[model samples]
Target: MGTRRPNALQWVWYTFGGKLPAHLSEWVLHDVTCRTWVLRHFLRALTQLAPFCVVVLLLPGPLHIRLSSIVLGLLVGLFYSASAMVETNEHRLIKHGYPPGIGRETRAIYRDLRRTARDEARRRRGWE
Candidate 1:
């Protein structure tokens, strides 16, 4: 199936840690890598927070309150973007042709490789 762009509500759900259905996950992963996924979320958060930042600065408020609002907006934006990490990783895995739940297997394989390399190094040092 062609990838359907997520609507606002779906985006909100995804931002809040909702899992995409498998079919959609594959389609989304086809379009986005880990870097683009992160940039997309960051841009989205900035887009949402920009207006709030402007309003906070423009509104008639004490200096401290305005500063606090700006800070709070930044914190909230970062939190919202970071909350999508799970979905981002899922998409990244699919993009790389790995099925869901392969992370542990991949890590184990990586660890084995590292161990073998280390053992080979030790053996070579012993010979020398």
Candidate 2:
């Protein structure tokens, strides 16, 4: 029997929050880390900001106000994209061959290693 392919709606749902099927999980994770994923999110943020920019440009207002509105809209869109979409991004990272808490553990290890090296250097210099 042929394997069934996911449909468009399924893809959207999975991208948002739906459970990824076992067979496609690896492929999805790889796709999420690829350059295409970054481009897709960048375009998504731009698309979200585009309408606001157009509206602000069309509004009857002083140039400074319109420019400020455009800037505000861009900031809001970026904040929304980063905050609201973090869950899905984290989920993808976790699935992409990274263990849960790997980021935290790695950071802690690096911090400790750097501290130890710094202390050793200071001791050698008679500063500790």
Candidate 3:
């Protein structure tokens, strides 16, 4: 398997903390280390919360009450998601046979390179 993508079922499993097949390891690494990983994390968190939110919405309630419930649920859910983001991604990578911290390490290297390039450009323009 040349870095196969997860099927919808596998993706749902993954979104709920399950592991993908070994051949999907490359995809997992990209997911955890991508430039949009934070957004991906937030989206995953939201997806995890969607079912409960739907239940809450479906229950008989005033518009304001339902809206407030959704808001509070999302805020708390996203707060926890953001707080554990780094560790979660690291764990995901580890579960997929990546060395511990590799995701963070890779992102850090990319970030450093981008910063270096930006600084070089700034210096070239006499802006710093």
Candidate 4:
């Protein structure tokens, strides 16, 4: 993790596809590849979906209809967002000057680390 990070405004800007300053590249890398990357990606998707959700709410319709539309829209939006989570993170990394596929590689390395740690713990407990 990097000591330097973007402020709230800069974070929102970055979440919406704006690039942060070069100095924050390390933070950006961590943001997209850390253990909480999935939650981070979903938060970004929600931030991007919020406006459209409000618009759906405002559109003239029956109460249930408008609310249902918002729900369905969000479900669809999140579906697509989840589908592209890896690519999206990779793109963010690229924008921060990381080579392509770093996100995937980083996540894989973390997964292996977790698996190794789990196996070690299991062995010590005589459960493996």
How close is every model to the real structure, measured as TM-score? 0.41, 0.43, 0.86, 0.91
Error of 3 at 126 (Å): 6.5
Q: Over all chains combined, what TM-score does candidate 3 have?
A: 0.86
Query: Candidate 2 lDDT, tens digit per residue, 1-128?
Result: 12454577766656454665667655554444443555656555676568779988999979999999899889887877877554555555576445665434544566688799999998999963
Who is ahead in lDDT, 1 or 3? 3
lDDT tens per residue, model 4, 34-120: 889999999999999999989888888798999988899999999999999888889999998999998889889998999999999
Candidates' RMSD to native:
7.9, 9.2, 2.8, 1.9
Which of the numbered candidates is closest to the native, going by highest TM-score? 4
The CA lDDT of each predicted structure is 0.65, 0.64, 0.90, 0.92
Which 10-residue span in candidate 4 carries the lowest summed lDDT? 119-128
The regions of model 1 sitting more than 4 angstroms off are 31-35, 44-64, 72-128
Over the stretch 45-119, how does candidate 3's per-residue lDDT look in tens digits? 998999989999999969899989999999999999999999999999999999987998999988899899999
Which candidate tops lDDT?
A: 4
